[model samples]
Target chain A: MSDTLLRLIRHGQEQGCRPHQRYLLDRAQWATLVAALADMPEVALLGLWGDPGQVHAALLIEDGLLIASCGVPDGRFAAFSPVRPGAVLFERMIRDLWGFVAEGGTDQRPWLDHGRWPVTGPLAANPAPNGMAPPQPVFLPVEGEGVHQIPVGPVHAGIIEPGHFRFHVQGETVVRLEARLGYLHKGQIGLMLGKPAPVAARFAARLSGDSTVAHGWAFAQGVEAALGITPSPRALALRALMAELERLHNHLNDWGFLCNDASFAWLHARAGALREAVLRAANTAFGHRLMMDRVVPGGVSDDLRPGGDAAIRAALAMVAAELPALEAVYDSHASLQDRMVGTGVITPALAMLFAAGGVVGRASGRGFDARRRPGYAPYAPAEAAVLTAGDVDARARIRLAEMHRSVALAKGLLESLPPGELLVPLPQRGGEGLGLVEGFRGECLHWVALDDEGLVRAVFPRDPSWLHWPLLEAAIEGNIVADFPLINKSVNASYSGVDL
Target chain B: MQGWRRLLWPRLAQGLVSAPLTDPPPVPPEEVVQALVARLEAAAQTRLGRSLAIRQVDAGSCNGCELEINAMQNVVHDLERFGLRFVASPRHADVLLVTGPLTRNMREALLRTAECMPEPKWVVAAGDCAVDGGSFKDSYAVEGGIDAALPVDLLIPGCPPTPTQLLEGMLALIEAQRAGG
Candidate 1:
């Protein structure tokens, strides 16, 4: 793991106007902005082609953000990539959804918006990507030398969601891999337009269930940003608590998978059981295990009830005590160690280039935690728990470490419970909002604009996987094809988050 | 004829046999429907779209669902298949599936197959550490699920949904949409 430098480089601030008083970057600007970011030496990169100009898009965490402008008609401008080796898939999205030209980009065809969608505009002008436009399946080209192609589903043997992966392999060795996603595009962005803030939040959280906190907060950021209201300290603290709780639960499950994949059945089962206990505690405390509907525009929808607090305390103590043994099981099992130790290794240099977050980079020895990166709240109370391993084993270790860290934070939040109004009071109208939550996966940046009546105008939440998806493609390059399952499980990037 | 050890071990079972077990929670979709009719009709959005049964697909997630999915279905507040049934396939499903990293193995199958369901299909990703690869977000073999496939309807936040909470999301979707298709 070498010392490599990669930082977000912003070009400018995009504006998001009134009603939804937020500004965003145009598709062209976003490309230039990322191009500047792509300058990090020794990087593998791709950029997105999102048409927010017609609809007021913004770059909240980086350069500029623009929101609440009119929608752009489909198929208008041609896509341009000022950077060398521009992304072909991005060009596909621009052409298919926005009906723009993607000049000289590879595979310039539909990516997500497969003709079945009822509406196919990017909502730059229409407020929807072609309202409920159904997608017609568009095939992708499989290329390589002496390549025999094998295609595995959108539906799966494990009964998971649908997605197509084409493996262009020579014998058993994979020469090239292409991921075809967005079989599940449901036009939520279109549906959110004109919906009340609270109503829209559900859609946000639903965008990717694992991203509930990020999407909810991102949507809330838009509403609150529109109203120019800040979350109460207590509200912010609670939001942090729930978000971390979500992170801990997710990490525990991932650790369990690592063990399971390596055939450490008992360790896997224990992790699984412990994760369930956390959910049980959540159900006891928040009334919903996943905490859906718990977050609203102003603040959280639920607070710690007296009994619930006690239940959580008990659960935390148990988890904190139980985690060490679980780690021991993972460490002690020789087979588990062998299976995980060096599988799917992502070097520090590569990690820096990709700028990946969560456990992937941490394991690869790149210490980038969103809580630490921009320095957000509650987490500000404590330091970001960063571990640099950069390997499957490293990622697993990070998951174990993060679980312990989550327990400590959960305990701290409970002990320092703040007494205040749960919801912020709001007037009848508009304002701009920007929300950046350190979701379990990593950074979830959301920018929103509201109408005069607090209705949602445009909501754009960027999931951490947006950055990590390509990195996943790179990390698996030299690894044996069979080791892919373990490696893929360890990286766990989100398609829905990136697709949205 | 039994020794004391045998008597103690066998006797313990016989002693415990006096109590009858509570019948298992009704699993038949019909039985669950019959029981939830009231809860659904009462707490349900008086609106037609207020009740929904969302089935989550394991796709390829680590069996984290043994708890999370169970949380959505079991004891404290069991969300029976009532308005939210967990159908095995997409054909009968109204809302779409969940969990993933789409896996080296599951990629193409998950896609061409998910669309077979009737229109107005929606998806819900239920965990942190799930199907868009969760911790496995970087695996090259994984295609990522949920949002990558079809439009996800909602996401139930957590590594797994507490049974009661997942129920809330199903309710919210049904209530908000007021129509499955």
Candidate 2:
């Protein structure tokens, strides 16, 4: 254990969690941990979620991942949001779902419960009927001359997921942009409980539809870890292959849309074609375009079909061939550059402060890819692309770099493909485990606690969007109103993932 | 002078001659397109050449359906060429293409959108969730299906219907509307 875990354990007892250490803290210890968060800027708060009787916080120290759990005996606990800004929304979500109040919390507003759920705190020990009329959402007031507010969506103009954005602006210049999400919440965590791990993995795949493969693999890894099962080498390589293909398709889609938002229709067209090709190849290889539900507990559900490797390589080659010309157009286009460069800048300090992951963090000079740390099998340690600018252009550049790397990685996995059994049977025993993977957007973390019968007792799927969404609010602080869409596309935070 | 010359000449010439990458609709057979086109044309004859204008509503989807729906606009799918285009507001729409299981938080928004659409509007439920809360039926937040909240005219079912299936559904929707009227 590291010094941080040792300090955390002094006030609590460590639980028998596989692959990671989880400590159960009392109220006093919880309060101490909350207080220490202010002084420990080096520690990143990975995830914060709650169950009926207790709350758990996943923390990343210099050495490894540590989970700190605190009992909510009185339905209240010390809030970490006062010191950790990233904990504010997580604390709110805990309140809305498990009915636990974060004592001395900075924000008291409801997060996912827009006051319209059938029951209040549906995951609470005793959920009650919610008959109260929903209240109008409130945004933080911005006071300045000529300042006005512009509210967009739970329904947007284009075909997209639903979420609200409140912009405070002064003569076309944005002062602050706050996102109001949770329109897609469907009790994901509540639905996963009590089901078998394989059955529950379906919900994980849908946490964010675009990240189905990554989320599925992460959830599967957690279950396998709990059972102390290692899948066949072929299964591990197949999972990586699916994940890389998913990354390719999604990044191509986003890159196209980013350019389209900048009014560069030509690049959008080319990128869209390439994305379609990638999706087609993925469908041929995995029998599903998005590869949903193909990855389950213990191992992957299917092996690669004959010529699957060739299909994937052909798609990759097409993309590779088009890259030089596509990049030249993007680099030379003055209008696109004007819209992207210096717009929606999330400073390196702010990125570090929030512990932002994925492209958003990497673009801001924080290099943290979950695949490289606490990593699983069939993957070589890879260097994440880091850019210091932290602007929309830097993010776009990062996506381009990641796509190239994904191509290489996918090909490498194909060459080293091994032959073996596809899955290992999971033991029917109780355990707790954590799974972390690098999805297209960033790190996707999932935690699962299984009962004696191998049924899911509690599960939390933490999307990387949780960290990037707040960074987006800060990124759009000073940008012009007209540039909001372009800025938003660059971040492209998932509403459904964060809503759950 | 040199910068301006380099910027405009080579790139402009290269862009002009780039062959189109769009392929014809790969599914739903050409006959379906012709039949739908014939129906649309007949309908247009009666309604001053108005094609189908749709407004998409994401009641509470996982966004997988939305991606396929968006792909309809891409070159390969090219749904707009079939005379169906997505509009910004429900008031301007002839159909409400709804996806996802109807969540309690979004039930009112979905209703308001359907109500705002001009009279003689059709509601097409796309995806397994919107048709009947596919994998999320037991959850407390979901209404199970769009039919629970609104009258669904057509149901296109899959975890998320492919772009080609979505187009076929749209065609069937228009044909159904014509025959029913």
Candidate 3:
């Protein structure tokens, strides 16, 4: 929180289906941004989210953070300017998608999208899919001693999401790294406009399949706020339980991947098995292994039917029994330790600049977790504890720490199962609302607006992945290409979630 | 053909997997069978209650629907018990659950997925994105809703619709067959 002061800065109405006309900073004002950052000691972040196709930028100063994002007429966005050199890319995305010009951004070439798209941006009001093919990617040449540029993905050897990685190497030491994503951009937010909230919430959950609970909860919170509905206390606790379950499950998987990446097969297999067991518990408690349809606005869709608890408890108990052994492997495995210890190191300063959160930030020594900070619902002040270190090892450790924390939360909820309605009815008169859910990733924000007809005016799932993706790109420096997987998994930001 | 092999092999092989505790006779076609009727509607075929084999396409979905879709195939609700299973390839699929709106990047892929599904294929736009491009409508690389690119059989709305609803939608597709698709 250095010069960044964290404050409860109230945000203005988040309009949908349209945005505020424009935010034109005069030359003096543009220069004043650097001055403003220096002047405000309590600014948490200089947040900027831009609509890749729109001409206007959504500029707001919250606490000391200067946020700059672009907006479509619908008030949603294509990409956000997360950190330095973002404006250049934002401008380029705008140019490629909307044919708009960013007044001052220098690098105006295509970023995630190619411009041969005869139609306007992907989410443009009118588009013809049959318009034209996209342009080919241009590879930037590497011209320095020992600085050979090697391009990696857009497609990988394994079954995973798509992304392109360019590494500048000095005989295996990565000097500079570049990542290009958007292969997964499925315009979900724009499609939500005009749809009923329940119908839209399901799409939100898929923003990242891995963080289904968090995304669903965040979207539900926004709709609930719009209708002024609070879930029954029992329902609230259930939501919290499910969220924590998801967190635990995800952490376990990451640990497994981290171990496997380090060639620690025993730990990987054990962790994967444990994760599989946890998912089984999830299926027994909620009807699905991933618990997808369970968390909705007001409350969950399913309750613990008879025999649900015992089965889940059995799985939880087994996981608890295995923790000590799991920790032993984590502590004793030399190769895993070597690969994870100091690789992909994000110093405390850079993590803050990039607004890294969740285990990624926690591992690096930055101590902000929405569950502890903003204090929402069942996770309010009482049960919110965060561990911060700011390193790859610290991140892995924090993930482990969070799993234990999740188990504790689950136990607390089950012991005092509240009896009442699961979900509350949404109020008829809908308005603007925002929800902040502490997902496995971090703060998953859903900014929503409802028309008089109860249709979604606009929905922006400001997933934590957006903030963490840049952090991954930064972390890849000074490491070999092979170590990338473990380091990348350390901050496993979801591409589909953020691209939308 | 594999279809006949898949059909005959299961019933032919049932005795090998079944124990005395789990042997139940298949109902005769003449018995009360609206569920079967629904199947005819679901697949545009005369036979009702045929096991539904679905092929799922990401086509740029956010992955919410994929999770629920995956959940439906798991043990809890056990969609498989209700005669539903997901096939890895589209050649065997009767229903296509498409997520995400058609992105410029994924338009060809999305159309290719739809084309790959055999005739009488039904497309269920699982999330808002597939239904109408969800929240990412106007960006440069996206093409709007999935239906704009393919003929849709049903619109199961949600940011990502719940598993129950998705199950219901698949069931509805079967029912549609009886009702005359």
Candidate 4:
């Protein structure tokens, strides 16, 4: 594998300017690039971008660098999933969104386009017309004498997002579990095309409501990178504060939910009250409970209100004081331990193959946290708390550990807050740039390519759920159908993030 | 008995609450509640003595509205104390509380869930996305709002409405149903 297979295709370069590199590879070179990516020790991301008559593949390697291979010049290209299993969903998305056929690809089923779209391949230059009968999606069968199939929702029993799961079972034990998603696809990419970075930031904020701060900051970083602007120190500190706050609230909520699933109603109620306090603090400080659209391109939407830091500190102090008692209850409850332990285990090998991130990846011993890896501001010197128990109990414990760390981080950042301007003016100049952030869920990566007029040419926001969801299918294997909810909560993958 | 006490005492002690478990209701202003009450009174006159049963359906939301809905059951709002409860089935529901912009893939599922509800059932659009599609209005995969698929009786607008707003919206819907509107 010669390094020359991936040649940098430059549009232009200037002195003292960051030159964005887009690699060009011949058809013969596609195999070499795929091999190089597969052979690499760690794979960060696999994304696809399409233009009329051609498609490009972007590979983010572990070294905090992106290698985008273009110039395929046709709809047909070699599939990377054959070499790297993590590329399976990305290839399926490319086929559905771009009308590009992943030649020799596994899993050709429709991903986000679930037969109801007006036309197939909406992003293609000339999309296929409506009324072409949608292909019947095949669920890989588990055949046996007594095996039965159980199909669950696009509409579930509880108040949660919609996704379908089909289980092949013999009696109560699940033989196979297949997830059918994209029930929440709102054509997010299509909504962002041609919009200015400022306008597109709103869409990014709502991409996943729970991870709004993380997604919004990533989008802001993307736009800032493209326009060659850096936010002020104060703004960066504020953003980091908000991100940690978001993480704290979400972790508290999940911990409550996990306890509730394990039949611990007391912890659930206490956690809810604490979570509400955090949200109220956020509302008083930032004007929105979820902090949606508060992080915008160039800087934050607003500065902290008077006494906001105290309010946040008070709320965090309450949570920090209360969580240990709840954890004591969780530890002492024999029944809860029985339910969580040794269930839905994912070995490190499987996690790496699926490229799992966040608590799921950490639980399984893959220590790749984007915040630590790419080393962003504020988190550059911080270390991610990694645990490797590889089970449902480990996942829950990881959330607990992260919640404590996030509280401490928020306190430290607020106490030593930087004094400076909160906003910077971004120039209306365009190029390509990448933004990566460690969201509460895992790594959130957003890539933006802007036209000369500063309008977005394309934007791909790859959520950590894209990689984690496939691992859920594998983790549920051999577990009883009754334990599905408990296992599912442990790996709480976002449906909307991946659906988009 | 000694061993049992040793094992359970610590765990039970940890669950104790030193102060009030929840704060005040954080209720909306009197005028807003009065306006809602007036409408509810008119509706209440028609169906004077019935409680409301809600069946929540998430069409395509980002789970923000779902969070608030779940919060209604918490100690603060304690929705059940007001004679309202979330039922497990649409067959028993008096109102269908829906969230999301009605994604195309979920249109059939939403319609089917709505159809499962008994007659005289009301549909309350829970968030801005369910009301008018919000940020996802221009999306190709979404049909804009719940109105595009079902007859939405009321619209509660917020990116994901606050719990107070949702409570008001539900109260209004209950009154609307009581009035036989």
User: Which has the greatest lDDT?
Assistant: 2
Q: Judged by DockQ cut-offs, is candidate 1 incorrect, acceptable, medium or high?
A: incorrect
lDDT per residue for candidate 2 within B1-181, as digits (tens), equals 9987986899789889986556564444445446545654554533312368999999889989998898888888887877789999999998899999888888888888888887666678999999998888888888889999987766889987888889887766555445434
- For each of the candidates, the C-alpha root-mean-square deviation to the true structure, in angstroms, is 10.4, 3.1, 9.8, 3.4
Write one digit per residue (lDDT tens) for candidate 3, span B1-181.
Answer: 9867866788668967765322132222322235444544555654434467777666666665655564454333456765777876767778777777676666665666668777766677887778887666764556778888887767778755766667777766555554453
Clashes of each: 135, 0, 65, 2
Candidate 3, residues A202-277, lDDT tens digits: the string is 7787778888888898888878877777888888888888898899888887787777778876676677666667
Enumerate residue pairs that collide in model 2: none
Native A-B contacts reproduced, model 4: 0.76
Backbone clashes, candidate 3: 65
lDDT of each: 0.59, 0.87, 0.65, 0.80
- By summed lDDT, the worst window of 10 consecutive residues in model 2 chain A runs over A1-10
Going through the candidates in order, the fraction of native interface contacts each one reproduces equals 0.08, 0.76, 0.37, 0.76
lDDT string, candidate 4, A184-282, tens digits? 988888899999998999889878889999999988887888788899888998899899999888888888888889888888889888889899889
Off by over 4 Å in 2: A1-5, B1-20, B26-50, B174-181
Cα lDDT tens digits for candidate 1, A1-500 = 01121122223343543222333344565344445534533333323444444432222233222232222344443333334233444556555555655554556557766554434554545534343434344554556668687676565433334556666677677665667776545445555667788877776776677667666876776577678776777887787777767887788777777677777766766666666667667768888666766888888887875577877777777778888877766777687888888777777776765556677767766565657644555666345545555778888887887888888888888888777778997667865566656677766666666768877765656567765656666666666677766887788777666555
Query: Who is ahead in lDDT, 3 or 4?
Result: 4
